[model samples]
Target: MSRGTTAVIDFDNLRHNFNVLKQLAPSKLVLVVKADAYGHGLKQVVQALDNVDCFAVATIEEALTVRKYRPKTKILLLEGFLDKYELKIAFEQHFDSVIHQQEQIQMFEDFQTNQVMNVWLKYDSGMNRLGFSGDEYSRAIKTLENNNKVNELILMSHFASANQKHNKFNTQQVEKFIKFKTSHEISISNSSALLNHINIADEWCRVGLALFGVSPIEDKTAHDYKLKPVMTLKTNVIALKQIKAGETIGYGQAYTAKTNMQIAIIGIGYGDGYPWSLGNNATVKLNNQQARIVGRVSMDMMAIDISDIEIVDNITIGDSVLIWGINANGNLPLETVASNAKTIPYVLLCQITSRVHYQYVE
Candidate 1:
């Protein structure tokens, strides 16, 4: 029997989003496929993005996985190597490594051998999460440029407030990155920065959420940017029933029916990567109408208040229901779901578990 839940990946939509970035000429799009393509499945995403300019992953393992599919495409290790062995593997496999700290620079120098390593010196332009301090960045660059094993060097920094649009820090960081560079190529934008129209990065842009058809900016949406969702999470109604007024439902007895009403139990919950915090506030589609979740979400199921939904051919057992993503003519945008869950789309999208079956829609 099927699991009754699945995540449908649309390759065409993925390509459409990538092409959106392609329109910004000269800024090479570094497709960020880290965290298993944001939990959309890594190998499949890599295969679909075969023609992309480059791929960025968070670890050496992810880089190798992408390399297996696209042997010649540029693969960047965003977190760089954690140890000497990984650093050696990066050099031998021709993967670009981002050197974010003085210790990382020291490691690169120590591990220098016959193999050449493509390097990107990370500049800490106020994010303070990673990268060398502004004071040490120049010294780090000079050291790498003098090293014979360093084949190419690029300057890159992360934005702390690109999504804010009006934040002065975005301009400040961009200008700081531009001034910090010493004739090397630069990359200083993510998905949000690319859409802000503030001219963040002209040489390269590392996009993750945007490529997956999600808006990184809070005030906008994927549709607003003409990007289509790539993942549609869906499930089927496992059972239905009617209950009298004042009867409680689910664990914690959080919900009570005010009157006789119909309910539909869906085969989806936090176990399937649905946010449990969405209980009583989440909406699901049934019979082409919206239904509200009635109780706390369980490990493997959730109950929706379909009491007012008129019973029809469209509403029945085995009927498919959209948990999130695009369905019918309506879209359950991840951004909206994230807001309802008191989280960000990045967490919700990446938190999708492996128990759910994935079907690719090309």
Candidate 2:
């Protein structure tokens, strides 16, 4: 049999998470399908959730991809059109664009089109990354409102620290965003904001990680919110070896055995999108037993200490290993793996390389 390095995408789990988020959300849901639906497969996800209120992406191409599958559903460009040509395409595709800068406004004014476009006016608020300053933001609202080319106008802002439930900055940002609110619809809550119960009444919520059955909140797992993991990454043990107490394992000889130990080399590593930085304290589920990682992770494989496993002798080559997700034993939350890798779940999911095969299940 071939190496069993695979990412299983459970559409049922995805739908369940969507329904859970819908119940928690105050109003409309703008499902963020950017980064290929957080590397779960964009086209598949867009088609699976055909009845969602809207699908938001980071690029115009991603929006077009969603439109290709769900022709009638609303698609939004989070970054908006970059130039006159993109602006034209947005109007042609009937995509909602976010106007965050004065330059985008100027492009709208210079363009000649009979078609009207829905616009999301982004305010700087506390996050200095995008959107116009307070003064500039006010002018843009007026400009878009008066422009006959603009159809629906929605006010929006981003949260800098919504993950941190008690951060005072969230309150400050919310207060600033409220000042610009008029009669237009608004979207501000992200996955963290909604999960943290920091949402406003009837505002659109743009959820990404949580939509894919992963938690965006710190110190919490998806199960805590009754969300099931959609992606379960799995691999297999390729080789097993026994080494003496003084022997070291893998590259850099980073891990030295204090006692006689058994090691299993698994057919997955950074090349398969498993984080290279993960080792030592990091663990994987093998045959319902926790196997601690040893030495530095290589490009193709890594070794796990399985000496403590009660069934060490029973585990042979090609035994299935759970990198992260639910199995017969129990669930190994991606959140836990992320913490061990010194990164976030988003990075772990998005960084999955092409070498790893993906299997979608209904």
Candidate 3:
């Protein structure tokens, strides 16, 4: 109801996605709230997902943040925490930690005498970003297994291209995960795999974006499935101008009106998670009609060429506009916006700045 832009999160949609996942896989669900539920608001998302089996975070600090809201929820620190202090916090706070490196194993080994930990062993498995390589994985698992430091072991790997429709890479990753599974229990499926790779869903699947119904792929959107988006990034038109043909607008004079047109500057822009580079091509919605940007997207505002939108001659000061979300029955997938930005859904979702206000919609 305010004049400025704000992001709206639909818990109903999140619950729907969670239910769809539950029906698809009986395996435990780790609601990936890492990166503030992909910038859908951290504390609010956790509160809405209180029914989830557990939540996963990249760092202990994130886990601790969620702990305040859901004190009893099972939490997994993805591939972080360097030493005993982090582990001690995990132990004391009762969070399941992913033992990513050998040093983390040593930290777990420190508490071996008194604590049996639920640990997911990170196997490099070709991601090569984190986890152990070669025999180091076997040695890490064996070390944890032998010492009783490991109460349960889940093998985890990050897929490089699980979202691609024709990627052979997923199959390759699955085979590698299967190899790790022979020696330990496994948890392999991220969002894309949970939807398309049912073959690997056993053992427990960790889902992040899909739980919020945002896809990683562009050509095929999450809306194609039973999934619906949980976040609606919205804004309002703050200024409007009528100009004749040959009138240039915005920075660098990137756009000049081909004919007399109406331009509306919305309150949301790059600083509010709208990508600046998309000034000329990105689409926004108003009065159920599409509008296109006419100039460079400034840090705090963007102008849309609304020449075709009818019934709105003068820009109503408080008229609503969409950044990347629903307008009527149509919705702009976060995937589409990210694609336009030459990035991915994960980065776009996480980069939503803290300036905008957030409200949870049930």
For every candidate in turn, the CA RMSD to the true structure comes to 1.4, 1.0, 1.9
- What TM-score does candidate 3 get on C-alpha atoms? 0.94
TM-scores for the candidates: 0.97, 0.98, 0.94
Candidate 1 Cα errors over 4 Å, as ranges: 1-3, 312-314
Full-model lDDT for every candidate: 0.86, 0.91, 0.79
Q: What is the lDDT of residue 93 in candidate 2?
A: 93
Q: Give the 10-residue window scoring lowest on summed lDDT in candidate 1.
A: 307-316
Q: List, residue by residue over 1-362, the lDDT tens digit for candidate 1.
A: 34479999999999999898788535688999999999899999999875788899998999999999999999999988889999989987899999998888788888758888789889899999999877688888889889998888988899999898899998888878788765788998888887877674458888899999988888578999989889988898998888789999899999999998888899999998999999999898766678899999999999998877766435778888888788772567888888889999999988888899999989
- Candidate 2 wrong stretches, greater than 4 Å: none
The candidate maximizing lDDT is 2
Q: Candidate 3, 221: how far from true, in Å?
A: 1.3
lDDT-superior candidate, 1 or 3:
1
Q: Report the lDDT tens digits of candidate 2 across residue range 1-362.
A: 66899999999999999999999999899999999999999999998885799899999889889999999898999999998889989999999999999899999999999999889999989899999878988989999999999999999999999999999999999999988888999989999998899967637899999998888887799999999999999998999999899999888899999999999999999899899889676999987879889998888899999999896799989889999988764579999999888899999999999889999998
Between prediction 1 and prediction 3, which has the larger TM-score?
Answer: 1
Q: Is candidate 1 or candidate 2 better by TM-score?
A: 2
Which parts of model 3 have CA positions greater than 4 angstroms off? 111-113
Residue-by-residue lDDT tens digits, candidate 3, 261-330: 8888888877787888798978878887778888999889988988788886755878888777775625
Which candidate should be chosen as best, given TM-score against the real structure? Answer: 2
